[model samples]
Target: MISFHNEGGIMYRFIFLLFLSFQTNAADFVHPYPSFSEGEKLYTFPDFLNAHYYISYDSENKSASIKAEISFKTEEEGYPLFDLKENPTRVELDGKEIETPLVDSPKKETKFRVMNQLTSIGVHTLRVEVPLKFLLRYTDKGVDSAFWLADLDDRSFLENYIPSSFENDSVEMIFDVSFKISADQQIFANGEIERTGDRDFRITFPKEYTSSSVYYHTTPLGSFNERRFEIKSKVSGKVIPVIVYSKTISNFNSYEESIRQTMDELEADYGPYLHSSFIVYDADLSRWGLGGMEYCGATVTNLWAVQHELFHSFFGRGVMAANGNSGWIDEALASWRDGGYFSNQNMRERRALVLDFPYVKKTNRLAYSYGKNFISFLDGNTKMPIEMKLFMKSLYQKKSWTPITTEDLIVELDLFSGNSYQQLFDEYVYGNKSTLDASELWIEPNSSEHSIHRKISGEDLYKIL
Candidate 1:
């Protein structure tokens, strides 16, 4: 009897262990930073807070140097990573020469090694000094702006400035940046101004936040009227104050309603608005093709691209993508959401933009097509509601920490749909079969083309004809 009781106790313990393992696996979301092995933890800031900046530009050499200092409180020792302009001639951290890895081409990143030995568990300082003269690559078209110190290049604009890492505790960060730029140009950055003097401006983040960028132009531009709104978080009851800056006063009115409506819809869909404040600044008309770039809470966009950038707050800024593969996930989701809104409003022209994925894929053939088509398929596939939740959970748990692939989606579909994704892939992606019978799926009897109807709610309608 004693032996039997002991065996029963052992069985109970084994079952408990299995239950714990499942819970741990389910809870895993967002990849831990690479430094986890180095005894570091990771945390993300809210989407609406903008990092403060202070910059002073030098006009003589047409080159700029910067000194950035950010303060954050933490329980465990952590490090900072700064994406530097490729032309950096010299970089000094805490007055010491530190080795920086050549992580990618045309974009250079340097990691500052915080002294964990002497540093205690509390507040820390990260000081970075950069010399930008080395970045100029002169071509026949004069100084190529491609090498400009602040250009985001291929990565998301936020990653360009902040060091993404693992952290043990939450902390507020304040960034004080000083830059030297051409005297003829005007400079702008994130947040409400504390002061502006001596060809330099100082900005402040009202809450805990991560990165900042400087915008400069040679020609002086007149300021437009600003529009403000207060967006409240449904979950936290926190409110995010917003401001929109434009070149012409009239342009502010054009984008105000769209921005407000987008924010309303986003907060309704996503968990909440994460930042204490947000800003949208006007960019040069000539550089409008670049669309908008996301920083912490602040985004710089052209007049026409304001709506698309606003949606970034939910996907791009809120749910961070670790690598290139998952990069398109947020972008495609945002495009669908923003574009779907127009379609629902009976604006067929605006809705047509969402259907033009084929043309976009053709234009950028090398880019990942899975994100675009996966979203479309999700709309058509009934199991997607459950699958997306499982997929996102898996994505967060797998901690792939980089971009995801089409195979990842297939695995997810298999899990949620309880059917092999091979059939779906062959029918939709590989063109081996058709999604629906063309003759039966037409919206209008006279229309020749077939329209495949999506099974998901909140998806745009389709009529191939």
Candidate 2:
């Protein structure tokens, strides 16, 4: 996996692009500075990233021919570092072709590096043709394709199919996508979509999205008997459109009913639903034991994990984990809700969530297990009844679309609870320094056999940011 290495003692003004344009010259999403050495500055990420993908999918051939025009800028000279698991058919730096040999061992991570004199201190563009991969597959009736990503999909995300950056930086992405399938396969995405042709779509995803935020899927007819309906959002008065699909119509009905109740319950708890619409890929997930993965407002889920996955739209995908260490916050929060918010359990296991590196893509596994009880314990320790729930709602309102850290959660909790829980985390969550070990840290391995259509996007797609 190609990731950044941050060195301490770096004091630099990184003009990060927020929801505003680069012309604003604003510094909204600044990279944290423990401090940077003169030598270490070269390894830091770019100031901004805007990627435009032109994709043409051929269903018969089961292939996707893709080209990405990635535009970015930097204040200082640095190398072009992009995490793409698939090798590019061709690479270009400012319209000039460059060789991207396999930088790592074939057994290791797939990586590409841009080497040219032009990679110095200004706006630059990398136009590359990404290689074809499993962006599509044949289901029994038709096909299923998705650019799905999750919290544990370490170093693999938007870059899994196209060229993209890390999750910390909310990159602006545009997709000019088209499909040449049996006229039956349909595209499902969470972005603003404009149909330009019979199967061509121009998708404009939110600029607030990071590497893991996009959820795009293409499923064929007969593979799923889909039912589209509407449900009113409690938080927002908008009548939210919902699409639920499954192999059978009975499953669709059951899922729709469950989704309605679940959405109402979650909205009653959290402030509101965060996405434009909600989509469910209700399937038998007995094969994938990990249950479900949540996208922004969508999920490929079984019936059991409906509430748990949807809760993520308000927390995990909504508030967003700034780094791997903070990733536990949502999982624990969701699992705590799953366990009925019981605040009386004894958290027997002690684990370490504080890792050496902040940007590790994998979260601590205990987040789904012991971490659940820990959050409940925190809630119990709070001053009011279900104070944690109220704090989470406030957090969802404030930090929605923002990336945050474990320390941020601590500070927020301290302010809301009027008590410091740092010592609680230091002892139970962080564990003893003498016995601290990162054995629990791991990435959720990608499984092709079964998945919650993990929260799986498009196009003014030709325009550059």
Candidate 3:
């Protein structure tokens, strides 16, 4: 569980880290992410939620609708905050109808739905209905639609179409997706799909899924062509299936070997791939090169960015970041892999990745460049025989599904390397307290990270999809 700490008007979620004489009990925590309740008032969320969404899409009219029934058990009197960017068609709390007033938070710069009435400490049920319009764009022969959400903004995860909770709570999300599409089509999701009826699917995700874990993309069969293949994981030798899809072009010939090599190396260095299968929506990513978004087991990527995005399946998507402040760890590791994982004896003169305020849910853009340099420094300079990479492999195996903080990473490093890395993190990663001579520092290029929002434009979305 998290307690709020207000300093200089910014509230921080203080996670109970294991530094004391006694270790914190395992069953007392939801998640370690710092998430603000975007309602009229701040509400403590101790409710574990499971949501089932019945979604129907009509591609001819470019419209859709979603009805979500969420069940939860509350420890105390609290508000069950769920976000649906589109004003919900209807909202029900415990089978009683409630007003769907849109709460606008200029501080968070988003609008979402929240329960106005607080519930008594017990199990509760909530229902939300939302309409999705104009989300489909027709191709010449087929149509293209994606429930695409990168961790781009405060309100951009699974909450866009279906009713979704915050990052701090892992929920089981079930999607009953039905289509009124005329063209023959198939749904691409990170979840396992079972065909229930004609043009209907029951997509069920793992019980331990958070907000940013699911990947859902839909298009006409010929609008995008796919090549399905299998690869043996390095650690477990588990035959993992991979599907690469593109806009009616067979451009995955050269990428097959790269994908195999990358997956093998990743599993060898880290552990088994957590995602049951991998799906790559290789949209060419040409409008801007070296940019893709990482989902749980799937990615939307190109040749140049394939390795970096796939590396995320282990670190970013697997060993998850609990909050935006902790978001630098994966980007740094992925970028370090991208930039050849160069270990440097000398530390670099770089800015901090964790900022001072309003950064609880925002990934620092400099995480790509400066963050990688710091990781390289850690990899090179360790008191123990093993470097930071080995520590990460162990961390991945231990904390695959658990969301963690930057402080947690530092503490783990301290324990693994048997040397204190806190001051280094304080001086370099969290605060710019170290002043070094420019000539003595290692200099890496100010390279952009692999994110579509930072690398591409609004016009590039359609092209990338």
Per-model TM against the reference:
0.51, 0.81, 0.84
Please write out the lDDT profile of model 2 over residues 204-287, one tens digit for every residue.
888888777887876664555788999987767778899877663454767778888988988888777878888877655534
The local lDDT score (0 to 100) that residue 196 gets in candidate 1 is 50
- Please state the error at residue 227 of candidate 2 in Å: 1.4
Leading candidate by lDDT? 3
Candidate 3 local lDDT, residue 174: 92
lDDT of 1 by residue, 292-326 (tens): 45544567565566666666555444444333323
Model 3 clash pairs?
none
User: lDDT per prediction?
Assistant: 0.39, 0.67, 0.71
lDDT of 3 by residue, 1-465 (tens): 232223423223122233111222231133532335644555445444578989887767766788889886554455545577777878888889987566654344355565777776556788888886424565544456677666645566777667777665678889998888766767899999999987888999977677778888777776667789999776787889999888746857778888999998888888889989988888777555536888889888777778888898899889887766687789888888888879887775857777553324546666777788888888877443447778988899788877788878977887787788777788787675244222212233344444532543335665555
Worst 10 residues of 3 by lDDT: 19-28
